[model samples]
Target chain A: MIVAQRKPFEEIMNMLKGYKKVLNVGCGTCVAVCLAGGEKEVTVLNTELDMARKLKDNPIKIDGITIERQCDREYLAELDSKVDDYEAVVSMACGVGVQFLAERFPQIPVYPMVDTSGLAANQAVGWYEERCRSCNQCVLGMTGGICPVTMCAKGIYNGPCGGTNNGSCEIDTEQPCAWFMIYERLERQGRLDNILELHAPVEWLDQTPRTLVQPGYKKVDPEDLV
Target chain B: MKSGSNLEKVLKAGHFAFTGELGPPRGTDAEEVRKKAAFLKGNVDAVNITDNQTAMVRMSSWAASLLIMQEGLEPNYQMVCRDRNRLAMQADILGASALGIRNMLCLSGDHQQFGDHPSAKGVFDIDSMQLIYMVKKMRDESKFLGGADIHEPPKMFIGAAANPFAEPFEWRVHRLAKKINAGVDFIQTQCIYNMDKFRKWVKQANDMGLTEKVYILAGVTPMKSIGMARYMKAKVPGMDVPDEIIKRLQGAGKGKVAAEGINIACEQIEEFKEMQGLAGVHLMAIEWEHKVPEIAEQAKVLPRPVIE
Candidate 1:
């Protein structure tokens, strides 16, 4: 899931300073699972922002609401009636959701209250660790299911560089060396030859903005209309 | 005659070669490189000019290599994968070759977090192994990594580093084999203090018949002080310093630690001379280049074999 952290309170407050009334929006998907932006978090932030504004000489009114996944257009329809009532919208969602909210209400200014970090796995409650980089090309089949693109610091194709110290990366002793783990796993599986297979340099797929059309959803040819 | 380099000539002539290291100064002082080169000019076959070693900013290695060449010493030009992509790497290879540099050492540099600029982004587009293969391809096949023909390709004696003492000890030999398969002509092991582990690793390489494929150089660094030894043992990643060496340094009597350090290095060189499948010793007198001549002389590797 995409993990995001809320922006500092001061930055969010500064963005809301000019507005007399604002809507605090939240997403109930990735951000909520990471504990950054959810229904409970939106209510808490709304109360905190209300109190903070009241203490300051300039006071403002703020409303809060959380909808289902904001990435989908259907769930975003729930905000149509209440969005125009406020002067501005502050989205407490991943970057994607924030952009979607902005697109949904073009008249009102949209500000992001959270910073999207990375695609991660929820290790435990309130703990998230990055597991994938969405690099488009996956090599887990050969790497013994370990993602070197995300785990290795250098992200090189052939690794366990001389900096592998005691099965840890040279950058940090605490961080396990991805290649070392891959080697150990492959060795145990009696597939050590996999490590010897040279991998060509990665051809980065994200060089330009990429749009994916699901196989079944691609537009039919115009010739069909004729 | 792969590169027609003096280091290559020495190894090819069946001589026990000796190489020294010269870390470029942090600032752009050409005299600093020349001054360090003076100490190693006649003492060793080639001097390895490090490329932003330890990830700290320094005068570029190619520039330092040219500076040392002016002093009549051959340079083993070192390039790391941390700072450049394939384009820059190949461009530098052509540029260095044009400048008459024949020896090149490829390394996956230290992480930027350990350097002055921790926030800097490292460009490890190609790791050391890939770098080796690329250099070899440019040299032998006269083709760039992307398969375009180079009008004039760089002919370099490619070298790569190996760390036998690093974790998953059994796999280190296989890693070296992989590097050898990548077209590396020489191997320089990481600094040695744990002799038992190194000997075992070398034996494994010999057993796998990897020693016959490439020249192997044993790395030796003279410990300047007890603090240096302790720091390397506890803090430096991938370095293995045995407890006995520390005890020996402590027993060197007050103020005599430096001399004892040289003695210990000399002793390691003596052992390397007798070891099978070993080609040479790479002396990394970090910040202590002045002592290399004495260390070489004491180790009886002096009057370095002058192959015609």
Candidate 2:
């Protein structure tokens, strides 16, 4: 799942400046699961903003609501009737949700309350870790399920840089060296030969900002759709 | 000489090859490069221009290297995989070669966490070993890493760094062998404050006959003071300075500490000359470039052999 963290309270409060009525919209999917943009977080942000405004002597009315998923137009349709009640929206979702809300509600300004970190998972409660780089090419099968692209500090496919010491990364001693982990795992699986063959450099050109076209589905122009 | 570089010529001719490091100034100052190169000239076979050593922003090593060449000194251009991708790396390699740089040292740079910009991303598109292979391919096979023919590939004498004191000590020699297999013609190690451990590593290299395959130059950095010694022991990662050395430095007393540090480095150099498979010494005086010639003379590496 995508991992994100809430913007600092002060930054969020600053974004709420000049707005008298604001809607705090939360997403129930990845951001919610990561505890970044969940309904619980929305309530906390709403309360903090109210308190901040009261302390500043410029109080504004803020309402909080959570949709099942912010990325889908069908789920966002539920907010159509009442979204006009607010002058602006504080989107507590990933980058995708904030853009979607902006596109759906053209009249209201949408602000992202959370910073999208990376594609990661909750390792433990209150702890999240990045797992996939979405490099568009997966090498897990060759590396014994270890994603060197994201785990390795340098993202070098064929290493354990010289700095790898005792299976730990040189950059951070707490984190395990991805290549060392791959070596040990590959050794255990008796596929150590996989690392011997040098892999070519990553195709960065192909990994640039790209759009995926759903196969066999008619692509409709957004203006023509409505 | 394979690359016709001065360092390569010195090593090939069986002379004790001495190299010094030139850390470019943080700003655009060609005079700093020339000033350091002038100090090292005639005292060392080649001067290594570091590429943003310790991750601090510095003048590019490429420009410094050319400046050193202008000073009539061969510059061993150092490269790190931390900043550039393979495309940029290969292009720089070709450019360096075209501009009279013949010795190339590949390094896995110090992480940016130690630098001014800790948030900057490190682009280690390929490891040092792979970098060695890529350069060798370009030089020997006359082809790019993608197998496209190069009209004139760079002819470089490949070099890489080895930190024998680093953890998994037993595997250090094996790692050296890996670099050798990747086409490293020479190896310069991390600073050696722990001579006993370095001896053990050299023994392993000798046993594996790695000495016969490539030239190994031991690294030496003279400690300026007891405080500096302690800082290196405690703060520097992969540095294994024995308590005895630290005590000796502390014993030097304020008036004679710098002299003691040079004496210690000279002793290491004397010992390295006798060690098996050891080619020579790479003196990295850090900010004390002025002392390089004296250190070399005291170690009796002066009057460098004039190769045919």
Candidate 3:
């Protein structure tokens, strides 16, 4: 999912301080499903920004477009005819989609309107909560489906710290102890002995400073690939 | 075989308030074939078969229109610019005419993001205004926009949309002028609820000498209940319902709101009866089509006048 949080309106207006003839380009894939970069959201955002700009004595000429997917070169090619009409583009997508739009419309300045958050799932209609941390090694099979890296505070390798007070993490009182969840999950699977296995001290090098390079089935050249 | 085949003639006849719609099967069930043609049969002048309603993959509108044709219902097949370029749009207009789908509604169509599938491609190579001019070019000159000759000339009744209640009301009238200038034969407006604003808009059109440019059907969708009214006002972008009607629904018991909403619409039709220069009403009671004949009778519009 394209998990994104809206940039504050003040922040967005700050970015487009001097620009007129802006295009509020939306990405229709992941960001759209999340309701951040869809046409409806773009319309609402455009209204808000226009109201803000008008209050500031700046009447900006803004038009909108929701391209199918900003990541694909073919889809981005759809903007070729209309790009010259705009001075800048505000892309309402993840960081990846923003970069892709920038690469496609190299002459036009593309600004990001969303902050890309960690991988998450919608808990229900409007709530999104983090569920998985791609730690490069998935040990959910051994741990009975509890994701210790994401759920456990301090990224507990083995057992809980003494800070667990009434099944709550010490990091924050409302936070549930991840190790406790792992223990309960293991108990349910009839493999309580699994918790005795001592894990080695771990480093989250790849997980931190995350950079994803998906190997190609892409038809275009690497130089041409956005 | 003559100009009677043209759209303006069919609309100016004025007795039947004709409308067209596109219904892609909600699922892949094959029985939807007979169901579609049967639903709209004889209910209106023609049923519109949509070309990829919302850009989701479905049975093509041509095949669906052909099915409706077999069911003996005239199909007003709609063509959109999102899926084709001008050349393809021109080709499809000829193709539709050959297939005996006479009435056409030219649309720019909704963006792909609004549909269930978002990763699909968008080809908005032309807007609705440009498509109208292109259709006129093919019809009047027997040639393509580039001056290329055609083997046979094609003629069609053309229509576009107008929504005075859409935000920034001034722009809506501006767009109306553009559509009339583009040679739209008639305008099937977005669902209208507020008659006061609508009357003002008609006055503006008349003041600008646009009252006679193209036949205008004040599009109306009668709500079945308070829930339906709320949903329509919420989801159907350009549709509006007045607070008094909302409060009327608020006062009327839920069990009888359908009849109440129908009565409210019937009242609107009664008031619309006095407006001069009207073609007819386009009642889009969506899914409640069975109530149409009753509502028309309640509004005293039944035993439709024989006008030509």
Order the candidates by lDDT, highest first — what do you get?
Answer: 1, 2, 3
In the range A160-189, model 1's lDDT, one tens digit per residue, is 988888889998878999999999999889
| Ten-residue region with minimum lDDT total, candidate 1 chain B | B299-308
Q: How does each model score on TM-score?
A: 0.96, 0.90, 0.55
TM-score of 3: 0.55
Instruction: Name the best candidate (by lDDT).
Output: 1
In model 2, the runs with Cα more than 4 Å from the true position are A54-57, A142-144, A165-168, A180-197, A211-226
Ranked candidates (TM-score, high to low): 1, 2, 3
lDDT of 1: 0.91
Over the stretch A25-124, how does candidate 3's per-residue lDDT look in tens digits? 8888878878788787899889988888899899788889998888787888888899899899899988888998887778989899988886788888
Cα lDDT computed for each candidate against the true fold: 0.91, 0.87, 0.70
Model 3 chain A weakest lDDT span, ten residues long? A157-166
Q: What order do candidates take by DockQ, descending?
A: 1, 2, 3
Interface RMSD of each: 1.1, 2.6, 28.5
Q: Taking the tens digit of each residue's C-alpha lDDT, what string does model 1 give over B181-261?
A: 889999888999999999999899999999999999999999999999999999998999999999999999999999999
Best by TM-score: 1
Error of 2 at B232 (Å): 1.4
